[model samples]
Target chain A: MLKKGIKYTVALILLLIVGYNSVYIKKLSEVKAAAATGKFDATLYAQTFWQEKLTPGLAKANNLPELLTLLKSDKENAFKNYSHALGIGNLRYFLIKGIGKITASNENDISVTLLPDSVGQEVKLATEFVYGNAVRDALGILSINDFSNTMDMNNVSAEINKKIRTEIIPPFRAQAKKSDVVAFTGAIELNQVHLRLDEIEVIPVSLNLIQK
Target chain B: MSPKVFVKEEKAQVQPPTLKAPAFSGSYSRYLVKFQSLIALFILCLIISLLSDKFLTVANGWNVMRQISVNICISVGMTLVVLTAGIDLSVGSVLALCGAITAGLLKFGIELPSQDLFIGFTLLGVVLAGLLTGTLLGTFNGWTITRFKVPPFVATLAVLTIARGLTMLYTKGFPISGLGADFAYIGTGWLLGIPVPVWISGIIVGLAVFLTNKTRLGRYIYAIGGNESAARLSGINISKVKTTVYAIAGGLAAIGGIIVTSRLDSAQPNAGISYELDAIAAVVIGGTSLSGGRGSILGTVQGAIIIGVLNNGLVLLNVSPFWQQVVKGMVILLAVIIDKANSKSE
Candidate 1:
């Protein structure tokens, strides 16, 4: 009886030890996945984030008119309703995907103002609305808490932005002929309140020339 | 008396001592298996603790328990099946299928009139759907094995592919997320400073120990496994016991699935791919003979911890995941080889 008691105690202790190790492993893996800065594929990361987070969030979002009403009625509530953040609302992210034309460009920034295909009768889209890095900042899809430390996230975002600038712009800029139609899926921030009704700058994660 | 007997050795014609087999009631070497798994677990704990300071900490202690909860849930059921000398290869796939179904059902809610009461019922429905899917698929595996006279390996392997395919088809190979905070609570929430999955699995282990030790079905399972012909001669329902075991395995797999989905907050169709192997290894390591009729859930519990510790320790040491797989394979091989040697001696 004494021997059996000892054995059971040992087994119990063993299980407890094993269980503790399990916790350590889980926390370590979480830290590991979040801390990775430069080693993974950027396109894959961006694409997955776009598809998994941005697209779904956008699909569930209210339309422009409905959103405008919400904004007017309750700006805080509107932001609360529309916003999603990895860190319990640290930074907000939004998605805007539709057909539009590039009405203007900044040669230095390679940035473009998009005229959305559909225009409201009385309201025009904003001109001050910038899409690219500014949109990236507002969307806050790649926040540090769920992903990385602030520094690592900045570095990764910079790399992704660079990949977009060097690879995406040269081909896109060469084909920017008159009367060209471009379809874009991009991200935007809700805080850009002073934008023209017809003008919105979208950071094109994927941009295409519909016709030239 | 001993001196007199020694002096009488010549008179007794130098009688040799008879070798008595180590016994459990009447069985030979019965306690060997009980000790072997315990010793293995002890060795694992010793090695891990010595190598890493992180191994013996309190926070990690709960972490291991929480992480191994799903593994325990699955392996406990596996212990029964392996004792019957049958295997459930489709358990991982069943987990994926059940998890996907559970999440999908939550998303595929009925157009309820009210939000408050309806959410409660809908959640209940989701849990039932997950369990039912697991049970039904497990039943199919049992049916093929018993009725069609198909081998357990081939039948479960086929089911693995079929269920996995169905899981992917159901979700278009994408993970289903947004399962709600309430759904997540079952896995991630702590009732009393312990993770919920740990509580869930602990209850399952208690129930399993009771069922196998105290129930008629348990006796029939062992009897059938020990000697199928003798069990049949004694009028034991072999097919029924076998089917029930598989069914229980399936239901248990679903429990694992739901726990994983809740923990991850999503159900990827690809989730649980090859998880069955780990569960099987745990059973085998627990000193359960793969040859049937001889294993206990208690041993499997230790076996699972052994594996969990090894994986955990290796990672804490900064070992590569690739090397971890190799070590796991070796552990399984070493366990089976020892089992073979022990069986030979028996």
Candidate 2:
């Protein structure tokens, strides 16, 4: 009877612990999903859009036939292609390939690891776009200001602004435009090009790509 | 048959006997040699005073006191534990755990709804957490030693690793910072021109003295350390008493951790990593036998003061930090040698 009582109590305790953990995990997942769409989500969307622009657009399209013919006949208008046509090709690559590996899912609130391999082999651009000290992350970083002390969001905003301005902004400026040259098998594979002018807006856009 | 005659007869019957001289002089010379710690402390202070100009300064002395305050406080408890032939390697980790719990409680409290309960409950929670954690750990060490019949060294060594690992797990290798202002006052603030830590250490040392000198529980600890089998035969409730000793030691260690964290304004998971070594060294240097029994609180106090002075003097002299460790170890060895030589002669 003593052994039976002990077994029953142990089983009940284990069940309660498991149940509690499951509920806690479910709540955590919900919070993470909600977080993926907030102001922080703007960066994720922009990165996704760049990744989609790379493989699908240029990999499928061929020759700027009309633009090339115009270019062959009139060399003076080539400057227009440089500003308009070349820029479009660069943007497309940036959106499709460059941005894919720049952002990924966060495992926890205070932790994030950028998955560079999501794009392609020899992913150099992905490394440049990601910021944050892996050592400090492991050792843990303290957020300035007590989140509980005041009803003030100013401290949080200040910290976020410092990180964005100091660490994030400069890199974005450098990688803002994408490369016009696309190489496949060690040669420039610029067989086709499509130059599209879309109106720029404050609203963020995400490029969606489905591989064939 | 008058009253005067009766008084005279009683006086004659109660006549005082002539006094005889004591066999030996009650000279302090004998005691001065026995308490070699007092001699070593005097020599150390003299040497430091002669070596450095800044050593005597008020500000620098305060700094030294502040630095060694936690060590001094914890060594008193360690002295008691060692007196019972038990080692407490877990004290350092216990300190870290207590500090982390204090930080966590405060952080959780601050995040809760702003009510009186938040602050009150937070303080209570932190203190209770320290007490509970320390007592639990001490009990575990005691149980392992007594029940499993494991040697105290082996048992406490296991506890040392386990407690440190748990501390790392709790903080995730991070330091918990931004404790409340009031909490910081315990370590940082001063009372009557002395740092609060010094005052706290003084009070604890006094309490430790009273426990070791005045109480039955304290006597039993020394007795058990002196002879375990004898104490057991005398019905001293060996298990319960030993457990209580460890629990007290653990609790005192937790207090040390709290004071240290508050002083630094953070609970670094690795803060108290090697503090236990210094504590043990202090106890041994104080003329306490490592084999257990036969030590005084006064000697340990002197030992702690000697260590505090040596560390302060080294820094004041601007000696290389690496070499300072070598010097300190040599000094401890030297003091132990002096103590042993003195005891043998006695």
Candidate 3:
């Protein structure tokens, strides 16, 4: 009699698991179909991410001059408060803005000296080529788990970089001259081990000429 | 409690019959029990070699050994725990925590009480700290079980969550990476043309075999698992032996964590997720009865190799990852069924 009860109990548990999994499997199949056909568009997703999330959130960036001062004094506390990290790795991203005079301009990078406190410390704004996941990761709004695979996540980064290259950098490069005062907001990627306070290389999201 | 009263309580509770040498069966059955897992491993290799050309190469052989090394270390500890009819669900979490702590220490040295005074540990010190963390956690698990009479499963399960939460808190949800070359050498460095992890696991297996076969504590462990009431009547320190076994298991898990961290050059908060399942599978597939007292470290080593080969071969053959999980589960079930049948025949 006990044996019979155990058999029925086991059968019921199996049935419940199967019932729950059926719904899960249906949803999985729908995702599989989209993945199989390459129907999930990462470029469009990135385009929306930029306009909807990043542009409106630019004001949230830490002020470059003030951030540098804090970093010089207390590196650990500064990173604890201002930086963003995703998943389980050693990379930290910072979103920062500063008003500076263009110290030097070139095809590769535009070196700018901050107006008030950071006169000697030059921040390079990449105008010709932009790489890395700075813009995608700096906001900490997009998660790697939300994407189907790493390739999709990488494609988002590529699309974001392409947008900056085409839309943001070209306009700034066309009219801007040497010693021109400009306000720029961008993302910077730093390796925790080799965080250099000397030179900050930024991948610009927006650059506006304040004075010619 | 008196021995007579303890024996009465033990006798009242139903227990599975221990695997004893057959009185009627000849040497053939004895050999089968001894060599079944080995035979299974050999057949698995033969099949994989036939299916994938890459399986027979030296590079691939080393890769398989390297991949199995972490599992082998965890399984060695698991084999000891299972021998006492206990389970440790926290090995995976303990591994992650230990690895995170090790990396955290290596990257940022401990700050002293006095301002501007910091102390950095050498490689040996960092590794010892990792092992100590695992041992302490394991000892706690054992103490909780022995003192409170809590089931090993529940005790370890609680520890699993606690350790994982502690790991995330220490790492602050970020991975610690770029550990110097000196530290990376433990994971990636090759000695005498073999991966370091393989060498480390080999030494562990050898020492475990010696411990189980040659020591009095080993005998006590088996005695407790075979019949606790009988062991108590024999005046064996069951609690001490059980706790020691668990501590050993935790230390081995820490070793595994260190290897994994070194190999990846980063200690991720999510490292060793679901690793306990793999270690359990290795122990079970190696012909160790989950009820305890009748398994060997060599069997676990062979079982780990089989699993590693299957993982490597499936990836080589372009099998889907989902299907691989299904196949691995079936293999474990098949192994247990075969073990049951063999023991019944004996």
The most accurate candidate by lDDT is: 3
Greater TM-score among 1 and 2 belongs to 1
Best by TM-score: 1
Off by over 4 Å in 1: A1-212, B1-33, B110-121
Better of 1 and 2 by lDDT: 1
Arranged by lDDT with the best first, the candidates are 3, 1, 2
Model 2 agreement with the true structure over B1-346: per-residue lDDT tens digits: 6999999878866764411122133245566667667777888888888998888888987888888888887788789889999888989988888888777666543322322223323454576667678778888888888888888889988988988898889889977776768888988999998899999888998998999999999899999999999999999998888888888888888888889888877888897887888888788788887768778777777778888888888877878889989998997788678767766765
TM-score head-to-head 1 vs 3, winner:
1
Tell how far residue A104 is off in model 3, in angstroms.
Answer: 38
DockQ of each: 0.03, 0.02, 0.02
Cα lDDT tens digits for candidate 2, A1-212: 99999999999998777545322112334444554664233243323323453223334322233323444565345323322222222221111112222222222111111123331322222212222221111111223242322212233333433443445444443433333122110001121233321211111111222111
Q: Model 2 in CAPRI terms: which quality?
A: incorrect
In model 3, chain B matches the true chain B with a TM-score of: 0.91
- TM-score attained by model 2: 0.59
Give each model a TM-score. 0.62, 0.59, 0.62
lDDT of 3 at A185: 95
